[model samples]
Target: MTPLAISANGPRESYGDKLVLDGLGLEVAEGTVFALLGPNGAGKTTAVQILSTLIRADAGEMRVAGHDLAREPDSARHAIGVTGQFSAVDGLLSGRENLHLMADLRHLGRAEGRRRTTELLEQFDLADAAEKMASTCSGGMRRRLDLAMTLVGDPRVIFLDEPTTGLDPRSHRTMWEIIRRLVADHGVTIFLTTQYLEEADQLADRIAVLDHGRLVAEGTAEELKRLIPGGHVRLGFADADTFEVAVRALSRTLDDMPRDDDALTLQVPSDGRVRSLRALLDLLDAESIEAGEPSVLTPDLDNVFLALTGQPRTAVDPPADHPVDPLTEKAVAR
Candidate 1:
């Protein structure tokens, strides 16, 4: 049987009279990454909160890790881990102490806690900095410690909310690799929310775009990019004379050709495929028009997010008491 890590239907939430999530529905499969992408205040965090049992949805049928979110929140909580955008490591604690603290909270015995702590410190490359205070650690080190702490319970599912927002490029890539390893090696399901389009592209097996509290689009990265209309091939020439000749010859042969004189380039609409490129090359060859090297311009996640969600991805500022940590009392009041 395929294990479902999270399932929800018609989830609704409101703050005062403002409805945040309207009929929001989702289902995440085991051992895969499900990325949630959205603009600020689009209820991405709210969705995570509800699924993790940190908050209650006004109305919904929900289950997480085989536990009913509304009726058995404690059971649901025991089955999942969360690492949010901000560093959850206490500045006063050493990296080793932080992991040990989580092990204690999970009720692991002295011997077991020590073993897990040592293993995670090595796994997260914190063995060298095991005794370094979190305040003295680099951004990457803190983030890794935060993740290591989350793994103490060995939850089958994890929710990572913008987990790499402030890390350096190399650090961000390292986190990506760690996330992949967790899913592949441990068979853990990951539910990720992030403003970084590149992060979603690199990690998510499937992506859902939320706009105005509703799921506006959902698909694989390539499938989502295909929705936009501007993907095409452009041909440039050294001089205007060849460009004009190519345009006159290829005008009827292509769909959309926006002629540019100063740059001596003719834009031709394309589906961004090898066959289409070959056809364009053959047409140019047949016409005997000297054309510059052909290039394919396909829409990326930035273009797709804008076209589909009508908004740009922006970092969500962490609330004063960020809820990423296990010890934090961030559960929403019922």
Candidate 2:
């Protein structure tokens, strides 16, 4: 088995009056994307804070990038980069300057800093806007710059908390491609926390759902989807007459198959297995009901999220004027 890049067991944390993380534990393999999925106030950020050494957990043991997070926080810090929900770019500085600032903080010498800065500007496609003030860059450009700055230190692991939260579709896709490249090309381990179910389904090698400060589910996307119950087979018809015929003929075996009159489609509940599909097809063939096409519809990450968390897969925006948790703000700002 591949070695773990991140491992934490029995992590606990609390706010002044309420417990936030209740003995949450997880493991992430090296060079893979591990997504922490949760609704708002589910302690996703809190877990990030603890693992990144931003906050001291009430009790837990963790190793990040081969360094004990508690005993060697500085070593762990050196191996990790963080991009939080908010942009960390310095608005007054140019993209190139932002990278240079990070290199300097990492103690890279003048020539090396300049070389790394130029390299990152080109890699992130920020060379065109390298000299432009970050304040003038588009949201997508700024995000790229932020990530480029994080790479200046050559971190082995990166924590991205809602990195595409406010981006447009195009920008979101751009970020996803970059994230994939980070793992594929650079062998970086990514710890992503997001409320976007599709993002987790698309990017994560493994996913864990956090609810009420505890992990309710963890698995590959397909495995988690299997935990939910609503998979089905959808059959499209060339005309309404065929759809009605199939519905009536299958009614004896399956009850209440949903039909879309306008689309001429019928949905039958099934496990989406080959045997089930074969049986469905045989019955349809026997009845002489010709479907235009048949598609096996399995449960998606949205269904898994809802089934595990008992919450809809909706974005829960933070409250206006919400006080920023100081520990997270401090860690992510660095």
What C-alpha lDDT, on a 0 to 100 scale, does residue 43 get in candidate 1? 80
User: Which ranges in model 2 have alpha carbons more than 4 Å from their true place?
Assistant: 236-266, 273-275, 282-291, 311-334
Q: In candidate 2, what are the lDDT values of residues 236-295, reduced to their tens digit?
A: 988777877877888887766888899888889987778889999999898888886689
lDDT of 2: 0.86
User: Candidate 2 — number of clashing residue pairs?
Assistant: 0
TM-score of 2: 0.85
Over the stretch 80-156, how does candidate 1's per-residue lDDT look in tens digits? 99987667799898988888899999999999999999999999899766997899988898899999999988999
Off by over 4 Å in 1: 1-3, 236-249, 253-255, 260-265, 273-293, 311-334
Candidate 1 residue 103 Cα shift, in angstroms, is: 0.8
> What TM-scores do the predictions have?
0.84, 0.85
